[model samples]
Every structure is written in structure tokens, then in C-alpha cells.
Target: MHILKKGLVILFGSILLSIGINFFLVPFELLDGGIIGVGLIIKYLTGMKPGLAIIFLSIPIFALAWFYNKSYFYNSLFGMLFSSFVIDLLSFSRGYIQLQIPPVVSSVFGGIFVGLGIGIMLRYETSTGGTDLLAQFLSKIFKINVGIMIFIIDALVICLGGLLISKESFFLSSLTITVVALFTSLCTWNDERTKLKTS
Candidate 1:
């Protein structure tokens, strides 16, 4: 029952993420930060699928989660897999529905959807891995806030994406990531510290 609940959360979260990416971001060639951004760059360069790239790229991140935090690994593994699958599934629906809006509106709304998906996963004590594991590890070692760590790593990824891709992609991606960061931070703040007290 617990497993099913978590799986459902990840499933819905992945759907939202896929909607943000395929319907909004991908059609515009807009990049996002973190592993997704890296995968996008790889796809742009190699004509490979982003979902496949995500699965391939997540291995190392899952490995890190395995070694650093077993709970995190177990929680995130299925979430990552299911999210990747959903992304691929929804990618096919790209032609059916698209924003056709301006880049700025798309970026903002796309970020909201992406962040909400991630927040739902995190709220359920699961993750989609990638820089999530990195941020967790850094938080453990550096005593920094987990959200802050994630933001920093995302910023670095955006910067590298800028240098690797075009400056326009970098700028748009940064906007997307910034909104995602803000929403995720707001959603996850103090979420884990609350507990029920039995009388």
C-alpha cells in the first residue's frame, strides 16, 4: 500500500514534468538546468531521445544515491524510472498539443509545472535522482541547506549549458530553472521536519 502510494505520486509528477517538457520546453528548444538540461544538450547534438539519455545519465546518480544514502536510493530509483518512461510516452503526444505562446510565458509556466512535479515527488519522500542526489550529498557534507545546494548545482549546470549550447538556450533555460528553483524551495521548505505526536 505504501509503495503504491509513492508510485502514484511519482507517476502523476512525471506526467506533469512531461507536459512541461514536451509541450512547452522541447518544442521551443528551451533548455532546463540539472540532468535534464544535460540530456537535452546531448539530444540536440546526437539526435538521440532525451528520455533515453536521462535513463543512461541517471545510472551514476543512482549509484551515488546507493552508496551515500540507501533510503534515498530506494525511494528515488523507481521514481526516476517511471518518470523517464512517462516522459518518453508523452513525447509522442507533442504534436497533439503545444503552447504556441511566447517564450517567456512558456518558460514561466513550464517551470511551474516542472517544479510542481518535483515538489510532489519530494513531498512523498521520493525523488527523480540526478542533481537531487548530488544536492543531498552536498547538504550532508557541507551543512548547507538542501534547497540551496540544489540551486547552486542547477546554476552551474545552466552555466555549462550556456557555454555548450547557444547563449539563447542558456538564457531561457536559466529562466526556467530559476522559476523551478523558487517553487521547489517554497514547496519543500520544512516539509520533512513535521511529525505526528501521539497522545
Candidate 2:
């Protein structure tokens, strides 16, 4: 029953992520951070599918997880694969998901949806891997806060993406990541509260 519940959560999360990417970000060439940002950069440059690029890019990170953190490897592998597949499967929706809202509105909503998806999965102790997984590993080794590492990585990705894509993308992506961080924090706040009470 627990495994089934986790599977369902992962599926739901993946759907939300795909919707955000296809419906909101793609329209304006906006970006999110982490591996997703890298994937988008590749997609924008080579016209390749972001999902495919994500999978290819994650191979080395996943390999490291397999060797050093088998538990993380198991937890994130399915989530990553499923999410990547869903993102690619929904890629066609970009053409049909036209919204009349401003680009800022789109970026905000996109961040919300993406953050909700990621946060929900994280609450269940699962994730779509990529840099999130890498951040965890590095945090363990360096005794740094995982959140800080993730922020640094995300910031770098956004900056790189902005430089390569456009100035507008850089600014909008900055807003998007901020919103994503807010919603993700909200979603996971209960866990932190529980830990605080216990500790």
C-alpha cells in the first residue's frame, strides 16, 4: 500500500511538472533551475527535447548515486524516469496551451506548479533526481546545507541559461525560481515543523 501510494504521488507530481513546462515555460522560453534549466538550454540551442536532454544529462549523477547512495538511487530513479517521460509526452501541448496572460503571470504560475510537484514528491522522500540528488550528495560530503547547495546550483543554471537564451529569460527565470522556492517551502513546512517538535 505504501509503495502504491508513492507511485501515485510520483505520477501526479510528474503530470503537474509536465503541465508547467509545456503550458507555461515553453511559450515564452522561460526557464526553471537545476537540471530542468540545463535541459531547457539544450533544447533552445539544439532543438532537442528537454526531457530527453534531462535524462542524458542525469546519467552521470545517477551513476554516482548508485555507487555512493543506493537508497537515493532507488528513491529517485523512478521519479526521474517517469517525470522525464511525462514531460516529453506532453511536449506537444505547448502549441495548444496558449494563454492570454502576461509572461510574468505565466512564470509565476509555472513556478507554483513546478514547485508544488517537486515539493509533494519531496514530502514523500522522493524526487526527480538530477541536481537535487547531486546537492544531497555534496551536502553530505561537505557538511553544508543542502538547500544552500541547491540554491547555488540553481542560480548558476539560471544565469547560464539567461546568458545563452536572453536577458528577459534571465530576469523572468529569477522570479520563477523565487516563486518556486516559496511554494516548495510552503509544501514542506509541515515536515520541518514535525522535526522541530521532535528535536
Candidate 3:
């Protein structure tokens, strides 16, 4: 029962994230960081499917997770898979999701939705793989916070994306991803505090 609930949470969360990416971000040529960011770069540069690129790029990160943290591997495996699938499924709607809102609105709201999805997955002890796995590993070894590591990694990716995309989109995408990371950190903080208090 618990597994079923977790699966559903991940599934729904991934779907929302997919919608945010395909419906909002991709339409505007906006990018986020991590594997998804790279996938967007590939899609823009090579005309390949972003979802396919995401799955391929995430393999190494997932393998790292599998070797280092068994629990993380088990939890995140399905979340990554489901997210990849959902992203691909939503790809058909690319550039077609009309909204009355402005580009900035899309960036803010899209980041929020993506962050919420990621946070829910984390709440269940699962993940969406990609640089998130790398961030966790780095945090443990370097005595940095995972959220900070994630922000740095994502920032780097956004910079690279800026080179590939327009400056305005790059800045907006960076802003969006900043909010996404912030929201994720906020969501996970209470859990960490609770654990610390209990311990």
C-alpha cells in the first residue's frame, strides 16, 4: 500500500513537471538545470527528443546513485523512469500550450510546479535522478548542503544553456531554476529539521 501510494505520488508529480517543461518552458526556449537542462540543450542543438536525451543523460547519475546509496537508488529509480516517460509523453504538445500569462509568469509558475513535484518526490524519499544524485553525493563528501550544491550545478548548466540560447531566455531560465531550487529546499527543510530534532 505504501509503495502504491509512493508510486502514484511520483507519477503525478512527474506528470506535472512534464507539463511545466513541455507546456511552458520548452515553448519559450527556457531551460532548467541538471539533466533536464542538458536535455533541453540537446533538443535545441541537435533536434533530438528532450525526453530521450534526459533518459540517456541520467543513466550515469542513476548508476552512481545505485552504487552509493541503495535506498536512494531504490526510491529514485521509478521516479526517474516515470518522469522520463511523462516528459516524452507530453512532448507532443510542444510549443502549443497556450496561456494568457506572460513569459515571466510562465517562468515563475513553471518553476513552482516543477519544484513542487520534486519536493513531493523527495518527501517520499524518492528522487528524479540527474544532477540531484550528484548533488547529494557532493554534499556528503564536501560538507556542503545538497541544496547549495544543486544550485551551483544548476547554475553552471544554465550558463552553458545561455551560450546555446538567447540571453533573455537564459536569464529568465536561470531565474526560474533559482526559484525552483529555492522551493525544493524550502519543502525539504522541515523534514530535515524534524529528523535533526528527533535525533
Q: TM-scores of all models?
A: 0.91, 0.92, 0.92
- Tens digits of per-residue lDDT, candidate 2, 97-167, equal 67888999999999988888887887787889998788767755775544556667888999999889999
lDDT of 1 at 179: 82
Return the clash pairs for model 3, or none.
none
Candidates 1 and 2: which is better by lDDT?
A: 2
Model 1, 137: alpha-carbon shift in Å? 2.5
Candidate 3 yields a Cα-based lDDT of 0.82
In the predicted model 1, the residue pairs found to clash are none
lDDT by residue for model 1 (1-199), tens = 9988987899888988888888778876777677877777887778788888988998988887778779998888888888878888888887787666998788888888888888778778787788876776786578665666777877887788788777887888888988887777676766634421221
Model 1 lDDT on a 0 to 1 scale: 0.79
Off by over 4 Å in 3: 141-145
| Global lDDT of each candidate | 0.79, 0.85, 0.82
Between prediction 1 and prediction 2, the one with superior TM-score is 2
Show model 2 residue runs off by greater than 4 Å.
138-149, 196-199
The prediction achieving the highest lDDT against the true structure is 2
